[model samples]
Target: MAEALLTLAGVHTHIGQYHILQGVDLEVREGELTALLGRNGAGKTTTLRTIMGLWKASQGRLRFEGRDIAALATPEIARAGVAYVPESMAVFSDLTVRENLVLGARQGRLDSARLEWILGFLPALGKFWNHQAGNLSGGQKQMLAIARAIVEPRRLLLVDEPTKGLAPAIVQSLLAAFRELKATGTTILLVEQNVSFVKRLGDRVAVMDDGRIVHAGPMPDFAADRALQMRLLGLAMEAHT
Candidate 1:
C-alpha cells in the first residue's frame, strides 16, 4: 500500500486546559479527496488547524510526506509543500486578484500554465483579475483563496469550510473547481458541514465529533447506510430528500 500523504496518530490538544482534540487519528492518502464532516464545534476546524501547526499538539505524532513535522512552525510547514485555505477565505483585501495569485506562488514567478488552468476552473476570477479581492462576492473570495493555494507547488491542500455562506449556484461552481483540482493531481482534505456536497466529491468520509474521528469509510458506504447518516451526521434521509 502507498504511504499516507498526511498522518496524525493519537493527537491531543487543549486551549487553557479545555481539551479540544483528544486522541484524534487520521490518515490522508495522496491524490484523494477526503472530507472531514461534523456538526458545529465538533473540532473539524481544529483538526485542520492542528495539522497546519496553527495550534500546537499537546501530545501526538504528525507526519507529512514521510517526515515528522509535529514540531515545525506554520511557515515551515507551508514551505514544505502544504497549503491552507482557512474558513475565512484569507485573501488580501486591498490586493488585486492578480497580485493575490502572485503572492501565493512563493517561488517568485507564477506558473503560467497552472495559473491558466486554475483560472479556467474559476472563470469569475479571470474576469476580475485586476479588481481588488475585497470587492468580490463571498463565493468569489473562496475561489480566489483556493486558486492561490494551487498556483504554487503544493503537495497537499487543506481547506476549511469552502462553501460556508455561498448560494447553491456558487457552491456548485466551487465543487466543480475541486474536481478540476483533483484531476490535476492535487490532494485535498476538506472540512465541510455540507453533507450532500461532500458526498458528491469525497472519495472517503471521516466523521468527527467532540474532537475525534468516530467513523470513516468510502463515500458509497455512508450513502447507502441511512442509519449511519442519522447517528453520525444527525440527518435523516427525509431532511435531504
Candidate 2:
C-alpha cells in the first residue's frame, strides 16, 4: 500500500534451459521487512537472484524505486541502491573486517555517523572490526555480511537465509538486529526457512513453491493458518512446538 519500492510482474527465469521461475509476482513496500518463505527448492533464492539481476528474467518486468531494472546488469542494479547478502554470507575472506566494511561503503566515502549507526545495531561487528572475516564464526560472518550491506546508502536489501546454520541464540541476536534495521527505515526482502524467524521479522510473508508464490499475507495471518503452513511449507506448528 505504501509506495511499492520493488515490483515484479509475471517474472519468468531460467538457468540454462531449466525454467526455474514461472510467472512470479511480488511487491515490496518501502520500509518493511517482507519475507519470502518456502520449503527447500521452492525458488526463494532464485527470486532474489532474479530481482538482483543475477539471473535475468526470461520474461516479465522488475521495477525498483519506480524505474525499470529488468535488463540492468547486477553491478548496475546494486549501484541503483539494492544490496544483496547471499546465503553464503559472501564476505571477503582475505580482507580484514574494517577493509570489508570500507569496500561496502557504496559511495567510496565512509561516514563515521553511518558507521556508528551500523555498529549500534551489530555490536559484535564493532568488536571484530580488526579481525578477518574468514576467521569469524558462522554467526559472526552473517553479522559481517549484513553489516557490509547496511554500511552503504541502500534503498532495498535482498537477503537469502540470514539465519542458516547458526545457534538459536545467534539467531535471536540477528533477529533483534533486523528489527533495529527495519526501524531505521531499511526495506528488507528476506528468504528464510526458519518459520519462527519469519513470524518474528516479517510484516508480510510470501510462500514460494515450485518457483512460484502461492500464498501471501500478513505474518500473523500466515502463522495462524495451520493448514496453509502445512500445505505450503510442509511444517506443522505442533511438530515444531
Model 1 misplaced regions, further than 4 Å: none
Q: Which residue pairs clash within candidate 1?
A: none
Range of the 10 consecutive residues with the lowest summed lDDT in candidate 2: 232-241
TM-score of 2: 0.96
In the range 42-107, model 1's lDDT, one tens digit per residue, is: 998889999899999999999999898889999999999999999999999999999999999888
Best by lDDT: 1
In order, how many clashes per candidate? Answer: 0, 0
Point out where model 2 deviates above 4 Å.
Answer: 237-241
Report the Cα lDDT for residue 26, model 2.
Answer: 94
Against the reference, the lDDT scores of all candidates come to 0.90, 0.90
> Model 2: per-residue lDDT, tens digit, 164-224?
9999989989988899888888999999888788787889989888888898778888888
RMSD of each: 1.3, 1.3
